[model samples]
Target: MNEALVRATIPQDLVKVLGVEPRTDSQAEAFTRSFLKNGIQPNSRTDLNSMLSHKAVVLGYARPKKDKSKTKSKRAKGLNARQKRAMKIFHIKPEHQRYELFLPLHELWRQYIIDLCNGLKPSCSPQFVQQKLLKADFHGAILTVIRSKCPSHVGTTGILVQEFKHIFKIITKEDRLKVIPKRNSVFAVEVNGFVSHIYGSRFEQRASERSAKKFKTRGTIDL
Candidate 1:
């Protein structure tokens, strides 16, 4: 808890492990007290040594003590700050929510989407946009963003899903050929290929097609 208490309690030999050879017990105690005053915890001698060694590694005073055996080497490898940051993949910042779920798009939101499309995230993956969408809990993400940024807007699952699809170019050009006429022109909409009338068209169209095929099968068997 207290630096004075920690120094008084930790062994003089372990304090020397910090690379400061003590001329006396008091010197060793002072040396140990100088660093890790705030972090020091009351623990057993072995645990105290391990904690100090870890602190030394973090401050660049020492590399983690290595072992010759292969198994021990793997176990000793601890992730530093840089490694932890590297582990975090691409994520959209909250500012990107300036793009409303509906029309009248903002330039900032549009530019952010463009950045994602162009592989502007950390790595060179062309599919980062698709990955971002797939990894997200679609409905939950929409609700979260809307609640946090656009609290006044009453957005639905269909509206958010369509907006996401238009932004990410999830719909194929061939699929658009038949339905484009049922909706506004691509350029007319803030998000290209987004037609208010055709928002839920894909789902309804697929369901109808499946129902028609099932009906035809029944008709054939009856005959």
Candidate 2:
């Protein structure tokens, strides 16, 4: 299909993929534009009949509650490939002049960690972390935050936030990076004074456990 036809048809396809019961024509159009830019796929039809004979869009006749505006649309930025992939399971809604989308269960855990850090005083400095990879106190504090903050630590013991190592290094030493969340959860944040979902994770699970067990048994750092 040509880009225009594909683009034109994309609104219907995205709603099918997004599973939102197809609310409005504008919502579908916005979704299609974002989905195509992000590289999401559409479902299959067996033949021309399925595509043509079944002329009904799942919620075709329903009109949107609000008028669609280019100005409102432009105010909200677009989604990239990675963000789109992350949002595959999320639910999207129109509100407050933007699309707010989320993965409910996943965010519950992520939010807990963020809330904890935001509550804590910034006592653990980066020089303290980098020079002494063995900052017993701060390391202990981090592990405590992880355990209390994340139950999934019982599994991989906490690696999801570890992906942001580049982000963390700045917070630890010379640079302070800040994260401003987008309407979409997966949107990237810029840094300055805020810590991102990214932090340099030399956070090793096995080593921490081994060291703790050894200290308990022999009362010494594991070497």
Candidate 3:
């Protein structure tokens, strides 16, 4: 199938993939646009259909959610090719993004760890992580924030491991540092006080501004 047809059909497919259906056509379009804008690829109608069918089957036999306190047997360290592909196309609406499409790194990391415990193999590479975050519907503005806040750590495997270890106490420091990156350089420090200027994330600020404007408009209409 052509890209246009695949793109056109993705919204309906997503309704099946993700249980929550958008209420209106505009909302559905918005959600579809976000998925396409990010890295969600609908290779072909048949492949997309087959993948969703498999997902449905998997959901039927899916294991119950794991408790963090309970000790679980560790699997392999890195994900295989098939597992990597699965992670790339996995589509579930982020719980924290009910109000908006962005979430904090802390929350994202927490969810990532939980998925790890549940036998999900996450992409350890920095570039893969960036793409995964975007595909997961995190706003692009977050890259700006992360780059500024952690300039020294950007694109470095060591810092990625350190941050993951810091958030989720499961991974050993030695094990975390084992997955070395190709590059480890503290390049130009584009240090900025933008993150410090805002109380929360840029997404949060934008959401607040939109909400205030909407509320004001509604009040005027009522008046």
Candidate 4:
């Protein structure tokens, strides 16, 4: 679309919402002509305002309107040499600092986790690490960590269960002879307790399951 039309037609509310001051008649119209003549174009909402992978947000994308740079044997235009110098002197250059940064995913995740942990009420506790594993299909490992530490799974499960329960009793005051759930069959590896890293990280779900097996072996190995 013609940038002039955009400048003329775009809603005032949109400019205000984007925090960009609405262009006055002279500047907007002049810039629009310069842009069209120079083969540079205006970007719409999506392309113009974007968050880079590194979390930096660019407010505008002012790329060349044409790909004339790749054309060879292209003759120069009728603009005089002194005019060219003046144009260069009066050109508006895009600067790096002009961009605005939106929220980055990683930072969002970190804040979310911290907020959840802090906001754990008695009625509904937030278990990020545990839930994250389970959601990622690491259910096998979650059980392993819980069960391996259970005395209810001794022979059918492992001596580790009883031993872990012992430590649980000593550490958690409520753990004194509580009726712990029996260990699930075919699930023995606790992730947090394991020292070896899991493979196939590309398979996030399966990898999470295997990786989570560590929490079991990495459990308190009694001295």
Which candidate's lDDT is highest? 4
Instruction: State each model's CA lDDT, in order.
Output: 0.34, 0.32, 0.33, 0.35
- Write the residue-wise lDDT of candidate 4 on 1-223 in tens digits: 9978865755777877777876677997677555544543445343321222234434489876776767666786687759877888433243411112111322453354335345433443223334433223321121222223445534231112112211211111122222223222223333323221112222223333434554433232211
For residues 109-142, could you state the per-residue lDDT of candidate 1 as single tens digits? 4454445446344453434443332222222121
lDDT of 2 by residue, 78-178 (tens): 89858976886222222411211122322553444335444323674533322232322121111111221234222121112211212211111112222
Candidate achieving higher lDDT, 1 or 4: 4
What root-mean-square deviation over C-alphas does model 3 reach?
33.3
Q: Give per-residue lDDT, candidate 3, residue 85.
A: 71
Off by over 4 Å in 4: 1-103, 118-128, 136-223
10 residues in a row with least lDDT, candidate 4: 165-174
Question: What TM-score does prediction 1 earn?
Answer: 0.16
Superposition error at 152 for model 2 (Å): 27
The TM-score obtained by model 3 is 0.15
The candidate scoring highest on TM-score is 2
What lDDT is reached at residue 196 by model 1? 19
Candidate 3 residue lDDT tens string, 102-220: 22443564455335334233435334332232223212122212232445444432112111111211111223322212122221111122111111222222322433443222211
Clashing residue pairs found in predicted model 3: none
